[model samples]
Target: MSQLVSLNLPAGTTVPSHADVVIVGGGIMGTSIAFHLAEAGVRNIVLVERAELGTGSSAKPLGGVRATFSDPANIILGQRSLRSFEDFNYRFKTDIGLRKVGYLFLCRSEAEMLDCERSTHIQNGLGSNSRMIAPTEAVEINPFLRKEALVGASFSPDDGFAEPEKVVQAYAEAAVALGVRILEHTEVMDVASADGCIRSVTTNRGTIQTNAVICCAGAWSQRIGEMVDVHLPVTPVRRQIGMTPQLSTPMPTVPFTLDLSTTMYFHNYANGMLLGISNSNQEPGFSRDFSHEWLPEFNAAARICAPALVEPELAQGWAGLYENTPDHNALIGASKTVEGFYYATGFSGHGFLQGPAVGELIRDLYLSRESFLDHSSFSADRFTEATKLFREVHII
Candidate 1:
């Protein structure tokens, strides 16, 4: 996957003198928010990025879009975004390569199976079509897995993966066409606020005098929030995905399957498969260089989940940052102290799937309108306590 070509965007001589709203970061979240705001007829929006668009996490070769979650708030967010992803080609005139093969969470324990059942109940209650299937049924959906190792699994047919780069390209192009200016290679230097309101946004190119600023900076959100004295508790953790070599055997089409206990996941990738394993001990940083340091552990997980994965010689596929919060949930809301400053970030590993819905939510947030879901629970204020806690926390 690659970034949105700079040639495709409107080349600007310099940063605009002013804008009604300045968006920091030009990844999927930022571009999606820009598109939604433009669709709402909001003008003079400027999206400033330090580098080319989609070079961040949004450029991942493939991203899973799902609405299956235990939390009611998250379920609705995913549901709304899933609808947007479904109508993307019609609404934005871009095919995102959306494959609704489904998402199957493989369970290996009774406790995990119970949680899957409970989450499925909540998902279905909130109009999210997710169900618990027996291990045999799961194997039918994804024949690569060993049926005997599973207790049961949660399956969501409405969920699947897509080319994230295309989605980002479409959003950025559409937003720009709607009069939104994108300032590429522009770094935000400082945010000037006074009297509990925003005065202007200072960048390397120039300052944008705006009343509102939205930090869609993803992993860099912590620093962006600090500019206005807003505490956005976001941490950047390096997440890597490995691409196995092309295999001689025909790879069967399968859902984006994940191991509930191990957090090991894999799905069809070209002639081989794409794989990722959640490393709990990975340090938080902006480092995104792919490495083979975790292969042993990943192979350990594959042994229990899918033994065949251990025999392949995998290449270092890609590395991206997962904007994580203390509880592994997102931080979305306005800053009480810095009145006009708001943030929509820290989705852990679920940002792309929920980007569209967050865009609508951020629009309502900036306009002071009632949103579809109660975003109070996702506030950054939850991290003020000494110990990390949230309404719901999931590792993957």
Candidate 2:
């Protein structure tokens, strides 16, 4: 947690009056879009952030990356994102701290194990090399796990974790180098549209007249949608994490392990462990205050799943918001009602890992070119349909 490599916009840089594309929210999603758009030869692109980059949920993620999803679209997105992270260091000259040790998802019940098997089958079909493993094999992969506690587990060697803040900064710096204007501390007041198309974006700095505006605002996406009269179904749910004090003894190299039954997840971080448990009673809003009441429950879960590790004192903990939707999936692509407005929010808790591929997809959508990944399933229009929405079952 040392000081992040500076990637801020130059001092006293003025906001432009017009641009080809305007992106709101400077988190992983927005910065990723800016980088990809600029890489694709879009020069006059502006990314405006109300705060510093990665100040939102992007900075608070557990940094888990996996392709073991029930939905094919999500699996494809994960695969492409993994590829991007693999090449990020070479492309950006910045190491994103990607650790591809693996992702181990443990299921306690037979029903959950069946779901894992089904998801693993779908993932393998889509070129994801994830597979259901025996409880003993799960222990073999990560010796710290309690094998008796897991009914089954699915693991993907290609899936792992990365430094979220570093990834965001890398994307922002690369975007700046490629001619994308990044305006930090600039609040987007309103998005003015005429005849169902974006006309201009009024911000605290100044008004930028642009035909296209991408809403990558993480937790604030709903408000951004309101600016354009689009009812984006996104809510901000607070998620908290606790970091244990660095252990005296060297711990086993563990993958990002998640107990699917309890929704408790943890992974190795530095010389300690970073862990969190999903609060079933968590109310949706923008409040990010950390609560100590959940500590006992989280401790119990850790004891059950990882009995090898003693309950070390929590060095520190913090809370962050998740841009959740009606379904746990993200809302990507253009709005049916708004002609020039695009969306790339509501990833629930998976935005950071999926940010890179989403950026490419958004760039393709903006240019009206064929996307590398099919994004029809992620359209904003899906919410209006009577059919059941695709929910990601592997969410931690």
Candidate 3:
């Protein structure tokens, strides 16, 4: 595997007055884009972040990475990302804590089983190693699961999880080593464009003269787009996660398991269990305050799906934002209204896993090179018409 030589700048470096390309957001997505752009020989690239890198939703993800998806686009992206993670330690010289324990989707109803079958068929056709399995087999893979609640399941052994913060640091350090400049604690105040073309970007520290800007702001993407008069259909939805006290027994070697009926998921973390459940009642906003109000719903689902975790003392918890779109798919590609302005946000809740692939895709689009995968499905213009959008079925 190829590796990028580090050229990181000293800490507290001054911000430059100009750059060839100015990328907003220092999270995983922005750093990935910056690294790929530098690899593509784009000189004088600058990445500006309002806070420390990975402090946003990227730092708080479950870190699940998988190729099993109902959509071919997502499957391809996930597969490519998995490859990157597999080579991360050697390529970036950093341990990302990648574990290939796999992903298990338990289906309790016939309708859910059918959905899994359909998704498995689509995934298998696209070279994904996902397959449908009987309920007994699911228990064999994850002995802690309640077999009575699952009629069937779909699983992919290639799926796993990683450390999101480590991934971000690797990308940022590598990008800097390749001549990319990173400006932390710098906020983009406004974007200046004329005649539908980007000219420069204004930040609280200073202004950067550039012809291109890529918004990878995640949950704050809507506000970033508003600076240039483009309406981004992204909303911030709060998702909470809880961690249980260390178990007295050894942790199970089970995959990251999800109950399809309740959208509850859990996986072993160190000696404890990390768990979370999707809440439809979560209002769209930017508030990330963690709450224990959803403990009842989580405990109920745990009793049915993962009985061993029932009534486990919750030791810690957190809330993070998901940049969601109407279709729950990502928004990528260039904007029609703003020339030289591009976006690669709105991954719903899967941005961390897709960051590497999306970065390459954005680099290809910006450099006028043919992309490795078709990105028309994720184009921003898809929402222009009243057409039905493609939705991913395996969302947790």
Q: How does each model score on lDDT?
A: 0.87, 0.86, 0.87
Superposed by TM-score, candidate 3 places the C-alpha of residue 385 at a distance from the truth, in angstroms, of 2.6
Instruction: Report the lDDT tens digits of candidate 1 across residue range 252-366.
Output: 8999999988898999787789998888778989998888776777888888878887755775489899999988999998887887888999999999999999999998887
Q: Model 3, stretches more than 4 Å misplaced? A: 1-14, 387-396
Sorted on TM-score, best first, the list reads: 1, 3, 2
Per-residue CA lDDT of model 3 for 1-396, tens digit only, reads 122243323455546788989999988899999999999999999998887788887977458999888888999999999999999999999998899999999999999989999999999898888989998999999998888888999999999899898899899988998899887778899999999999999987778899999999989998989999977789999999898888789877789998988888889787888888887678889999999866777789988988877776889998998999999999998988889899999999899899999999999999988988988899878886434333333331
Least accurate 10 contiguous residues by lDDT in model 2 = 387-396
Candidate with maximal lDDT? 3
Of candidates 2 and 1, the better by lDDT:
1
For model 3, what is the C-alpha lDDT against the true structure? Answer: 0.87
Q: How many clashes in candidate 2?
A: 0
What are the per-residue Cα lDDT tens digits for candidate 2 across 335-372? 88888999999999999889999999999998899988
Instruction: Give the TM-scores of the predictions, in the order they appear.
Output: 0.93, 0.93, 0.93
Q: For model 1, what is the C-alpha lDDT against the true structure?
A: 0.87
